[model samples]
Target: MPIYNKLVRDRIPEVIEKTGKKFHATVLSQDVYIEELKKKSFEELEEYIAAETGAEALEELADMFEILHAFAAVHGSTIQGVEKIRKEKEQKRGGFNERIFLVDVED
Candidate 1:
């Protein structure tokens, strides 16, 4: 059996069981869960970057979306709350829609 020491989605164990595969998993402590979430986010981001097709990119983005929701819940907030903050920041500064790149800023 291949060893996977990383975090997985909640239903992964059930999925594996359906394939008659025995696996080992443990519930992470609060601190460890948070750390794993951060790590998972990076993993998902890397997958997204490597996606060659639009559908594959979308699938990876959905995984990242799920991770974001889990992160919000762990921090005692909802996706709506995070969106609100995002909107506020967008209104104050701006968004990436312009595709502007800053090469240098001299004093």
Candidate 2:
């Protein structure tokens, strides 16, 4: 199967019928899509920052922007609008350093 294929509500039911197995598939309505996207974004961040193992910083950061774009759409903002805001923020509050520098403390 190809990664990152688009799915629809009807295909979900068709899959269920063909498989003959009970699998829960969530169909996010327009309203629920927004709410769920926000919740999922935070959950992913928590997993990245508040957990034991190291999370791929690039992958998680991409996920954050993916959800943020979805959020922009939900609120009727275009990509240009989002980009403008991003640039504004970058100019006002600079971007992060690419290097991950850490100081170790000795006991």
Candidate 3:
């Protein structure tokens, strides 16, 4: 009977029930959901950072991408819209393909 006070995938409750273990769960409000999504995004990012292999990192990266899509949808936008915005930023500021690391700035 472990207590989990964090958010989980939508099917998690159903999976838990299949094991004949009683669980307490409730739907979150839109505001709460967004807040939790933000936290979940960071959790996933940390997981990606701690991943030991390329495949593991890619899996965590996919989780982060899913969270991003959900975040955009919650904010009354779509993943396509978010991609458009990202592209615009990349066009203006340039992408990280250069792998440039800034060390210092002098006046």
Candidate 4:
């Protein structure tokens, strides 16, 4: 049996069982669940970076968004609240539409 210590989607065990193979898994505590979700966010971001096709990239991006929603819920907030914060930051600092790259700032 292969070892997998990473977090997985909710239906992973069910999917594995459907393959006629037995797998072991544990339910994480609330604290551990939040930590795992944070890790999963990074994993999904890397996947989005490596995606080649538009559809694949969009899928990965969606996965990251889902994780974000989970994080928001864990923190007693909603996705809409998160988006409001983001919009506020964008309004104040601006978004990436400029694509400006700052190499150095010395005076």
Candidate 5:
């Protein structure tokens, strides 16, 4: 009966029940949900950074991707809308594909 007071995916309870494990979970209020999602995003990012193998990294990245979608919805936008903004920024300022590292500029 370990305690895990954190946000989880919607199907987690069902998955736990199939294992005959009883757990208690509460629904977060709108404000709290947003806050928790932010926390979860950081958690996922840390896991992604710690991943050693390519497959493990991709798995962590997928988790972060899910969090990104949740964030977009919480902010009243869809993933498509986010992608559109990203493309516009890319067109204006370009993306990281060039791997350019900027040094200090002269004053």
Candidate 6:
């Protein structure tokens, strides 16, 4: 029955322990989680914009995906669940396969 589950990353867990906060605690507050996700996204965006290497951009993008996944989890959904819905919609309507029309963008 703990609030705010601990998200461990390197020395974070140890640091939190020293600070007397419970590690791996369950997150029960929706508002708190939303704010946390927003902060995470902002931090990731900063790094993405400051990145000097192509690999860094990819890493930042991965971080963005993680943030999205966490947001879905907070709302009781998984990434797979989203994909299933997307696939169903595509099947019912049209997917990239049906978009035969193509044009060069840079031209």
How do the candidates rank by TM-score, highest first? 1, 5, 3, 4, 2, 6
Q: Which stretches of candidate 3 lie over 4 Å from their true place?
A: none
Residue 107 in candidate 2, Cα distance off native in Å: 38
Candidate 1 displacement at residue 34 in angstroms: 0.7
Candidate 5: C-alpha RMSD to true structure equals 0.7
Judged by lDDT against the true structure, how good is candidate 5? 0.96
Clashing pairs in 4: none
TM-score of 1: 0.97
Residue 54, candidate 2: alpha-carbon lDDT: 49
Q: Could you tell me how far off, in angstroms, the CA of residue 34 lies in candidate 3 after the best superposition?
A: 1.3
- How does each model score on lDDT? 0.96, 0.69, 0.94, 0.94, 0.96, 0.76
Question: Taking the tens digit of each residue's C-alpha lDDT, what string does model 3 give over 1-98?
Answer: 68878889999988989999899988999999989999999999999999999999999999999999899899899999999999999999999999
The residue-by-residue lDDT of candidate 5 on 1-107, one tens digit each, is 79989999999999999999888999999999999999999999999999999999999999999999999999999999999999999999999999999998999
lDDT of 3: 0.94
Q: In angstroms, how far off is 17's CA in candidate 3?
A: 1.6
Give the clashing residue pairs of candidate 2, or none: none
Ranking the candidates on lDDT from highest down gives 1, 5, 4, 3, 6, 2
TM-score per candidate: 0.97, 0.55, 0.94, 0.89, 0.96, 0.55
By TM-score, the better pick of 1 and 2 is 1
Model 2 over residues 1-107: C-alpha lDDT tens digits?
33322323356667767988665456668977767777778866875675554457666776677777777888899767989998999899777766655598799
TM-score of 4: 0.89
Candidate 2 vs candidate 6, lDDT winner = 6
Reference-based lDDT, residue 107, model 1: 100
Winner of 1 and 5 under lDDT: 1
List where candidate 2 sits over 4 angstroms from the true fold.
1-22, 50-55, 92-107
Model 2 Cα shift for residue 53 (angstroms): 7.5
TM match of model 2 to true structure: 0.55
Position 19, candidate 4: lDDT:
96
